[model samples]
Target: MKLITVIFSVFVLSPLTVSAAPQTTSGEIRFIGQIVDSACEVGRAGTLSSSESRQIELKPGLKLDVDTYRNACSHDALPMTMTFEPLKTSTDKGIVTITYL
Candidate 1:
């Protein structure tokens, strides 16, 4: 279970407030249960430069769907590598690679 996370933030100052969003950059977001860990390899990781820091915090709650990785059903259907549109209307794309046991 992996999710491409789009982080957003908000700030408040005595009833006046400002909002900020996570700068979106193309990257490979890996999902494990409810956690979306960022890539931490040497120099081959995805883009995080355009990603902006946040001012406000949010409840950590987003789970990548295993069903979202399901391939199209058909008689001759092969194991498929597929991705989907992001949830909460922000994610542009998602991809899933299936591994059998």
Candidate 2:
């Protein structure tokens, strides 16, 4: 009878002791990004300056016209053409063309 009781106690207590043991999980997380030219905000008359760094969010269909002075600001303003195309996923494909003029 004592042997049976001891066997039963061991079977039940073994699981409890095993479950109480500490568990550890390890992995790695990485972040990737890029540093690009800041956006230049134009004036009310639609003008941009070399000193200004403005950020603009482009949607599917939007157009903008901007004019800037030559080497007026620390950051010389440059003309760029950006085209956004929709892809199969939620992300979009952007095509950027920079012109010296």
Candidate 3:
């Protein structure tokens, strides 16, 4: 009985240790958005999706500097301006809104 109990207890405790093990996530601020005209000119009118937003981490009320990204959305001739706020919610995560502007 004692042997069985010890083995069972160890098995249960083993999972806790494994589950508590430190883990890390990998990825960058990824989101899909569209760009109007006014926003592209001044870097506004940009929106990001929540699902994609979760990919990155950010801090609450963290205002990020404007960033510019070029993408071929509709026609190769037309360029897309991607704007978003980068925030740091964790030590290894960041959140940003990517949109076509």
| By TM-score: ranked, best first | 3, 2, 1
Count of backbone collisions within predicted model 2: 2
Q: Judged by lDDT, which candidate is best? A: 2
Q: Return the top candidate by TM-score.
A: 3
lDDT of 2 by residue, 13-62 (tens): 99999766664437554444563443434432234444334443456443
Model 3 alpha-carbon miss at residue 26, Å: 9.6
Q: List the residue pairs that clash in candidate 1.
A: 2-31, 83-94, 83-95
Q: Which regions of candidate 3 deviate over 4 angstroms?
A: 24-42, 45-101
Give one digit per residue, the lDDT tens place, for model 3 in 35-70.
453222222123432111111213444433232333
Q: Residue-pair clashes per candidate, as listed?
A: 3, 2, 9
Cand. 3 Cα-lDDT: 0.42
Please, what are the lDDT tens digits per residue for candidate 1 over residues 1-101?
12322222222342343223233348754443552333221111232232322111111232232221222322333333333335565664333333332
Higher TM-score: candidate 1 or 2?
A: 2
Off by more than 4 A, model 2? 25-101
Task: Give the Cα lDDT of each candidate.
Answer: 0.29, 0.48, 0.42
